[model samples]
Target: MTSTPAFPPLKTYLTIIACALLLGGCSSGDEPASEPPRVALVEPLQPAEPQPEALRLSGVVQSVTTTQLSFEVAGRIERILIDEGTRIRRGQPLAELDRVDYQLQLSEAEARLRQLQADLARKRTLLAEGILAPAAIEALEANTVAARVARDSARRDLERSTLSAPFDGVVARRLVEPNMVVAVGTPVFEMQDNRHIEVSVDLPEIAALSIPLGPELKAEGQLVIADVSLPLRYKEHSTQPREGARTYRLVLQGEPPEDYNLLPGMAMRVSVQRPPRPQASQDQFRLPLSALQADSDGGHYIWQAADGRARRLAVELQEVEGDQALIRGDGLQAQLPIIVAGGSKLHEEQPIKVQERN
Candidate 1:
């Protein structure tokens, strides 16, 4: 008699739960209030694989060194040996001046030297014969020495009439031609050493400091100098601050191409590589920027679909690059399916129909 109080039928309770599920289940078409949008599905995207180690940078090519060539004597240029862009050898005569005036001075000095020689010989003989004082004989010898010195000075002046190249270089520009009047020390040619070339590029101070002195910065993709790679040696250092920001100057050296077609002031693009970080190279899955979803508490997440049902996953974004984002969290990988194309239209724990990206 004690425990026989009747309870509601089990079938009634089961029927009630069934009705609730029917109401909550996903709607296909015009169940208007319950229907959801068709979102794009995306597979996990990975970073581009690393190829051969190479760095690219942007730079302008210029001559290794430049020098101004000038004359040692003032005179009209008698002959022009080179025009602009003509290559010349070291010590080669590039121009010459009229030598008549200097030659006449040399002749005059030589004649005086000959007359002094005769007089000095006469004085010595006369001194030995006791007809001349010893002091006068010594004075005559001194005059002979002065005449010889003048002759040597005139010889140097005559040689300076021929202007020669101080170093092997190309005559980059000519300021004077044949019969052109030029003063002493006037620059007649702008010369540049075209054998070696340098590539210089400006970098932000932070980036420049990170670059090592001898790192091989390769020119990749499209470049002015094709298929030819050169090892870099750091050449110059400079520091200047602009707009309260600091920057550094860097230079690299390489040989000119065989065509010798490389010219000064040609610009090229370059790229520098950031060394790998200890934690940055971990195994993880990355997705497109469209895959990230946020929660009310400001947490990041993604919607994972499995067997036609969806589950919400908490994810952490390490970095974002362009259209892709690198992320790591529980159960994020290729083996685990997630929605990429439909991220923005999803609710946590909502059922998902995964489809490929359109």
Candidate 2:
């Protein structure tokens, strides 16, 4: 058998119940602290209508004209007045062949011509006096004419013995040395005209088709050489693909600055400026630079505040100026609120509170 415990007084019971209520109320009221994410917001600027996008492609700078010089007649190279890297003016003698043999041939031809002329003169006099036949005088006159033709031919050969510069250029290579016998049309020197240069670039088939052909594109673009930007003149393009099925060649001509020496085979950039097509989506926007964030996979993203949550949108970054970025992405709207500051700490669809800035 167990004895029953005595009941407590009403005041004590009330005090105990009150204490229990207070503990239960305190336990129910306790909660974890939560603060809304503070983010700096900026309104994206509406991209200007028909904004021009610059296309940059790399190319090699080369001379517009390159030539190989040679003589017209076979002879021994008597003298080479210039060496490699020699700057030459038009009509400047670059190399010379031995002219002694040519000179001798010219002299012999001249002597033959004089003898034939004298004989013809005597025959003419005799024919006029009826001492020589007409046929004999005609034969002597023909011989004199043939001799004169030979003399003229010999003179031309003599003049052709010297090789001269056809234009202002720098000598790239000297193929023959003094005393070296060279045949007719043998390359003696290699020279380049550097006053004007061309940039050679290979573009994909699609890009090539978009560009205007010769002389029409000169006003559309310029080339970047080191720190200088020079106007480009459209030269030519290849119809056939090179290296790959989609690559085609484009040649653009430009003059080098007088103060800067632009040599052939130098690498440089070509920039083409043109307005966007009329039917584009017009979704590209310029936002503050701080709004951009790079993902670990090398993709760019921007945070936009929508429905009180942060939305991360992938973007194709076009160009970045001091504090503004030209970006293109899907679902981009004009004047959308972008999180410029505190975007690095954001997550997808996270709660966000936009902080207005002055």
Candidate 3:
């Protein structure tokens, strides 16, 4: 009876109960949300792979020896056997000149020799018999010697009328035609042997002296188009590459592939495998030149990967090559393949996705 008197109506009681229940529900403890599986939002921190050590050298391609063949005597070119770019062997005839004059001179000398020999013989017999003086015998002997000398001269002249290859090589220039008149010392053929081509390139002074002689330093030279790598023998180094420049000249010997067919005066790129300079203690890490970034404290650092996360590593730059920078420091291992080509836009601790290069 007392509870009924206090409550204004059952509906009001119900409304109050509902409000209390709603408050209780709002204040009650909430069920904890399941974490997003602690997924490592990071790129794979794969160890850097062993990098290929190479020296990139660029210069002009040239031959060790280029033969410029010339005519020893003046005459008209009668028969030209070989054309330009023809491969010639040693002592092979290249051209021939008119030898009728030389043959006539040779014939005249031979006749004179016979006459002189006859005169000498007659004079000797007369002197022996006391009919002629010894002076006559001596004069006949001198005449015979002079005739022999003339014949020898004619023989040399005949030989000079023909052009022969001195060594095996490919003909580079054929400057004369079959009927062209050539003079003494006139260059009619230029030849070169491509079996072993010399690649002469300049290196910085520090790099030149550091390179040792012998077979240990042959560069693995490869042609870009052909993509064939060949060994380059260290032939020579210039004492003074150039004044005021810390550089030296290096000569490498090797034969390019048949498809490449390198020519003299042609430019090519050479890949030189440069191990860490001798006695250099620190390991070398080659990265893109653009990978360097200066911090506010003026410290140099590069983007390093750690635990599938991006990290900033303090690094010291040692040298710089085209599109590459050599750095040294910890947190970098040779087994890890660093970001070389694309590493410009990256931040510390930021997630990264490695895009495979095609």
Estimate candidate 3's alpha-carbon lDDT, on a 0 to 1 scale: 0.72
Model 1: lDDT of residue 330: 67
**lDDT by residue for model 3 over 1-358, one digit each (tens)?**
4564564879998999999998987789666664331122222222222444666778567887798888888888899999887877889999999888888989999999999898888778888899988776777788899999999998999998988988877899888888888889988988898778888887876666555645677576655455566677777767775777777777888876766667787766776665553434446666666666667787677765555556677887776667666677777766453443334556666565544333
Q: Is candidate 1 or candidate 3 better by TM-score?
A: 3
Q: Against the true structure, whose TM-score is highest?
A: 2
lDDT of 2 by residue, 24-101 (tens): 978898776676765556565457245455567778888878999999999999899998988899999998999999
The whole-model lDDT of each prediction reads: 0.73, 0.81, 0.72
Off by over 4 Å in 1: 1-55, 128-131, 213-229, 242-246, 271-358
lDDT of 1 by residue, 1-358 (tens): 6788888999999999998877766543445465454444757445433323335567777789888888888888889888888878889898889889999999999999999999898888999999988998787788889999999999999999998888887889888778888898898889998777777777676676555545444332124656554444566656664455565556767776565466788776655555544345456666777878877898888877766656678888777766777788866556566677667766655655668665
For all predicted structures, in order, the TM-scores are 0.58, 0.63, 0.60
Model 2 bad stretches (over 4 Å): 1-49, 219-225, 279-358
Name every residue pair that clashes in candidate 1.
Answer: 40-341, 56-270, 56-271, 57-269, 57-270, 57-271, 58-270
Clashes of 2: 0
Candidate ordering by TM-score (highest first)? 2, 3, 1
Native-structure RMSD, model 2? 11.6
